[model samples]
Target chain A: DAGITQSPRHKVTETGTPVTLRCHQTENHRYMYWYRQDPGHGLRLIHYSYGVKDTDKGEVSDGYSVSRSKTEDFLLTLESATSSQTSVYFCAISESTGSYEQYFGPGTRLTVT
Target chain B: AQSVTQLDSQVPVFEEAPVELRCNYSSSVSVYLFWYVQYPNQGLQLLLKYLSGSTLVKGINGFEAEFNKSQTSFHLRKPSVHISDTAEYFCAVSEKAGGSYIPTFGRGTSLIVHP
Candidate 1:
């Protein structure tokens, strides 16, 4: 948990709608990550931010976008929601980028209809 | 790139019984291993990690794991488990790449502790 909070703990939206999830951290960690959890896939990183306004795409970045305008907040946006994007989304923060434990926030479960 | 493999999908054990959750990884170089536990509707909590030094690492809640470099494994064990121990466990492997160590997780193994 580690002082991380994700907005809209649960949401149900229809297909072709736009959705945004927010991750806020009080720890001032430099690294922030967005991930999605599916039944067979453990947790796939969608995107990550190393610093303010610095972001990188992960393995599963398609159909998703991220922005980190400040050190404490990272946002994940889906331009058009799809059934395939329905999953539990988690946010994690790390003090360093290497060999460090990342603290996760309570997940946001989003269901696309 | 580093990848992890959790051999079991689910394991059922009785309360107060011993249990072991298996984890293996494939890495081309030195790696760091970690175990995290997730309860129902909760975020993951770190159980233990092996960065270097000791092969036998002890973690919270009477849990321990042995780092076997030759076997490329880091398996979690507890002498006795409780019903509260029923949860999903994920194994992660990380290696340094471009000044970062973003871990790759394995499909979690659910431990069902029955009474």
Candidate 2:
């Protein structure tokens, strides 16, 4: 887990509901990323933040949003949760983007019914 | 743009047997390669990475991978395996995206170690 923690390890929600997952890191890393894991798809990046208040879209950024107000916290929000968005979400942190290995958190399992 | 491909979706091996997991990537620019292992109910852990200086990169738990530029591949290998070695492995590629680099990961290959 590398000093990273994801809140609400397990959650069951209804469709069209709003959900927010929080990732907190004690390492003070400069980079944070949000990813989803599903069967047949190892891990797909949803969004990433390079620095505080700086964010970028990833391969699968649709239906998801992210916010980074501080270096230790990166939040991922699903404005309107859908059944397709139900998956295990992982948060990763790294000191730098290049060459440096990113450390991942345990993960948050979100289920949309 | 960069993409990674892991040829096998699953690999089965016996204890103490050698095993190899194939990985290939396509990138327009120079890239960094990495291998990660994830156990059941656990987050991904870095097995090894190939940044520069060496074609053969060794990693934790007696795992190694070779970077073949001509083939556009980085395959992971281990001489002997244990039952604890069973896990899902992922291959990822990182290239310049703006001032930083973003990694693109393959689907993954599940290794089942049989006794």
Candidate 3:
């Protein structure tokens, strides 16, 4: 929705395969986040980047990794996909870290077989 | 650490009926409250937020929420809901920690409006 876009909106992959999701923002926001949405879990943060090359893990960082080599792009990688990792992923951007509303992008739905 | 709890997992109501979605949070320091709505196959959109001055906050689509400091709760309410109002609502809380704000979100409440 806001100038954010996620690539590969839908994908199906087998177990133990590597997958990467890309998030691109045209707003030039300083903060970007990766989150996963499951049936019971609303949205769990996987990783976040404060700036280019500055990344940190979130509550559900296990089995996932992230990289931000540029201000406009953030990448989420799954080294070995599992059935448990199948979920809808969303990317969000914020102008500030505190009290600022985070704008979300169109989600990417990934299914692991 | 901050955590948000949404009391209802799902609520069903008829058109033109009123609705209330409950939310509570636990935090050690001051916090900011927010409500977000997600329609089918869509990303979340901000409905309202309680930053500082007002305890009662009005948001888009005639929705409103009240922040209660004593009860540590922020509940969303609407007097008259339309069929188009059916969606999933999520509550979130953010607090400053280590010079950064970390937000914690609730599971979410699914609102089903029937004719």
The lDDT leader among the candidates is 2
Listed in order, the DockQ scores are 0.81, 0.80, 0.80
Which has the higher DockQ value, candidate number 1 or candidate number 3? 1
Q: Whole-model Cα lDDT per candidate?
A: 0.93, 0.94, 0.93
Residues A1-113 of candidate 2: C-alpha lDDT, one tens digit per residue: 48999998999999999999999999989999999999998899999999999999998999999999999999999999999999999999999877889999999999999
Please give, as one word, the docking class of candidate 1. Answer: high
Off by over 4 Å in 3: B97-100
Clashing pairs in 2: none
- Model 3: per-residue Cα lDDT over B35-62, one tens digit each: 9999999999999999999899999999
lDDT of 2 by residue, B1-115 (tens): 6779999999999999999999999876778899999999999999999999889999999999999999999999999999999999999988854423788899999999999
TM-score of the A chain in candidate 2: the value is: 0.98
- The per-residue C-alpha lDDT of model 3 at residue A96 equals 79
Residues A1-113, candidate 3: write the lDDT tens digits: 58999998999999999999999999999999999999989999999999999999999999999999999999999999999999999999998776999899989999999
Q: What tens-digit string does per-residue lDDT give for candidate 1 at A3-94?
A: 99999999999999999999999999999999999997898999999999999999899999999999999999999999999999999999
- Real contacts recovered, all predictions: 0.73, 0.75, 0.68
lDDT of 1 by residue, B47-69 (tens): 99999998999999899999999
Residue B29, candidate 2: how far off, in angstroms?
2.2
